[model samples]
Target: MKVFKIVRVLFFISFFSFAQNEDYVKENYNKTETTITMRDGIKLFTVIYAPKDTSKEYPILLQRTPYSCQPYGEDAFRTKIAPNEFLMKEGNIVVYQDVRGRWMSEGVYDNMRAYIPNKKGKQIDEASDTYDSIDWLVKNIPNNNGNVGIWGISYPGFYATYSLLDSHPALKAVSPQASIGDFFFDDFHHNGAYLLSYWRVTPLFGHEKTQPTAKPWFNFPDLGTEDQYQFFLDAGPLSNLDAYYKEDNVFWQQLKDHPNYDDFWKSRGIIQHLKNVKPAVMFVGGFFDAEDLYGPFNSYQAVEKNSSNYNTIVFGPWSHGDWARNSERQSIGNVYFGDSISHTYQKNIETTFFNNFLKNNTQVTVKLPEAYMFDTGLNQWEQYEQWPPKNTEKKSYFLQNNQRLNTHAEKSFTFEEFVSDPKKPVPYSEDIKMVFTPRKYMTDDQRFAARRPDVLVFETPILTEDITMAGPILAKLKVSTTGTDADWVVKVIDVFPSDAADFPETQAYLKMDNYFMMVRSEVMRGRFRNSFSIPEAFIPNEKTAVSIKLQDVNHTFKKGHKIQVQVQSTWFPLIDLNPQTFVPNIFEAKATDFKKQTHRVYNDSSIEFTVLKKK
Candidate 1:
């Protein structure tokens, strides 16, 4: 009892120390507000926080965001800055800016503003805006060092990515943490399937502002009931959403305009323009991140293909921005990934990355491994010279008779069929409450989904050995649908033992017995099975190959735990329901376009996993 009391006291002391450090930094720093003008003559609002002690030169860490840098006045300071308390105590000049047309900034706001490659007079893009901002900072901000480093999460992360293109020479290091690479693949849509959960935040992006203001011009509507799934179902059809959003919402109108991966979305993608990146880049993402997983992974690949800069990636067992926020409690949903996993990353990887490049911390050289990824199955961090670790062997898990997953293919020429009804689409979660974002669903238990008649469940025998997957998971299916169009939802799950016991850290409400934890999942619209640019309808009863590339997963199916694969046609309120009819523009589809379809998955269909061999 004495030991327990002593340990509890020490824990609070340690936590207090970190909090005190953050408070001290805030007390010591001076906040100043200024406007930086872009080449197009639009002025952007910026907040600069410099330490009171000018004892030594500090590098500039700038972050540009469409999300307002609140506490507008010069006297008001942010309580915490620089990713975590570690970097804040390191004493760097932290700069935050409201990107053009956001908050106090002046100009017309554009969503994921397309980058203009060859600009004539008065033409501008996000890259040019970034260049101008950095140029202004170096000239105006009275800092000792010329070195500039930029980093951001989510949309701000998008700005960080854009800064890489035509990067300023002064911009030395950049970390696009959970960055959005493409609108079509990342946040809003995945392989042409719209994320219905994002509908809540659409008003935040869609509404136009008459002038730059501190508060939001338009507010997200309160979806009357707590049950969003039922609300969305009652709302009926994607076309009906416009009635609530109205025509004034430019972004809503834009979504209606471009139903396909047309030139508009193509030009907005930063991957194509990521050539010859000069900044020292470290792309960070989460293996379990529900949103923007496509960004960091694809951005890293694009950079590797285009540039030779000191580029690296770090994918932790985290949700969107979990590393920054939930530093002490390292868990997503019910899956506890050990304590201080996020703090370890912030102190060791992130802070070290910035200090090495920005502060020139000579104790450790800035040369890092190509990838520093967390293995969720093993609950350990692994560093590799290359991603998808070259030591992996490709293994295919074929769907066989009696809903089993085996290495050997079943040549019975049989298929599993289920009737998919749009009216009663399978809910993404069993939970009844509403949320702006369904982040926990990324790791939520799938036992509820497996019992659904419309979903196909396949599982491997309780693993005799620990099977670890290291890289991307590809699902290749030979399927036939009764309707002209459909959406394929694939889930990779880890089924706990029937007699499993909950860990001490597990949430009280979560039951460990027969737990089915989702590791990786993806949705692909059937029409885009051929091409995202063109919509192709499925011929009735004709077997077609539909390939779905699930996000990269670093997980282990522990010994005694079963590996389960769930295939379903609908994930309602999470992904927009497919009308299951040949509609050129799904955004404009009528309620009658929605229909019931029988989808068949052949026995020959299989999922390929990149399994890592144990050392």
Candidate 2:
């Protein structure tokens, strides 16, 4: 019996190679469903899949999305169609659409819409609906290749950064992963506060659909407790959670009618109109992207200071769209980060950034790095020709007199108190899980916020060699506040070495011995310090200077590890509690305007850090 016929021909060759990879897009694509139109005639709703291989021609890619581009009709295909799965098994036409008013599109949804600049007639936006959906998909699809490539992840990465503004000369290339450049500092405000963990994602962008649908018009709001910090501290203030969203959420009434940074958040800030940009951009994100890390580092430094074009940026050790997932041990919660880092960023940097600009006789020459990043305390992937890498060194530290963090300063002036208690605030996470915006508290373990006495810890002493740091952290608070509005937060930590070894992906009642990790953190809103369009309040005790910034980070601190620096003032419910009184609207405060006050920090409170210089 010839060994049962060679195990029945190796189980019929592994069941026909798992049915040709689960019906490779219904065995080599062809799924249509159109609409397109745009430039104000509206339409949108697309879908396409193409590729039946009429011997060649392909490249289209696109994405758009307001989330739903579901498996709707036209023989419902999509068990994965591009943007990974190695660009959905190479051979693109792909497309998805449904943007303008979202789902089956027709126009009306505006959250983050504002980008018009020189549009004549029907004044459309998302860069003229991505330049009229890449001019009707390179003039009506088919086995074509007029070349176009756009990607998305997170609000379709903000419409792949609005197709690099007024673009579409066959679009060329764009990435924008984990993007959202600014809903006031990337995803529901940061420097001006208010991110109660993105308040149940405001009914999927403040509901209001009436037609053209395939489903999910918007629902998520049954917050009846999973202890989301005692359901947002018993829903106190934020106008008692606006009765779980009253007047049918139009972006939660434009977040209670623009809580500042006016011009309705500087006209939906697409990174100050990412100037002259025209395709060939990358800008992916996640340095623990607890929601857009201020939109891919201010949209890759606003297209590297107003685009020369072919700009780039990667940043890994992901969290929000973990490099558009495929997963194989690339952890983030208990920190594991390696092994197929999102399938080596989809076979070497997103299929060589869309096969070196939408393949047409392509061999993919791969020359990326304008900053790839991902150190997260040395986990790996680095490369940079520029990106806070002008051989750094800004340094600063300070906050001294016992609890040190030195680099010298604090000759005499000393202060250090804390009280803060907006009814006992300060728990950004010890697994507060009710997440929508938590992302493992972006590399958590701050020793439960440095044993919170309303946090203010500040160490340094042990690291004798490896420090690294690399870019953007400012902080600079010489404070005082007996309640007149406050929020501060600023983290940074690294600590580790108490014989640190717990990684089997840690967390089993944790133990990386002296772990404290949390590489970077932010949250400002001390009445927007001087102005996020005029906020100024803390005059109660007056030391006032403030500053904050805190976003970029490459991280190393290794030698014996220590670095620290906590400083806090209620990061509870992750922003939105700062009612130390000043009210023109702390989203309509008044629970006795949240009292408990005290707060101080001076010792010439410093911080700065760009460091990185040992080549």
lDDT scores in order: 0.85, 0.80
Q: What is the lDDT of residue 9 in candidate 2?
A: 33
The candidate scoring highest on lDDT is 1
The candidate that achieves the highest TM-score relative to the unseen native structure: 1
Model 1, range 1-615, lDDT digits (tens) per residue?
242232223212111223544357568898888888888888899889898888778889988887678667776666677666788887889888988877789998899999988778889888888898889888887764888899998888899999998888889889998899999998889999998888877876888787878776776666689899999999988888877788888888888899899999998899888889998889999888888899998899889989998889999888877777544667887787877887888888888888887778322375677899998978898889888799999899997757898888966788899999998999988878776566778888898889989999999999999998989999999899999999999999999998977766556777889899999999999999989999899999999999999989888899999999999999989889899998999988899999999999999999999999888
**Candidate 1 positional error at 31, Å:** 1.0
TM-scores for every candidate against the unseen true structure:
0.95, 0.38
Candidate 1 residue 552 C-alpha distance from true site, Å: 0.3
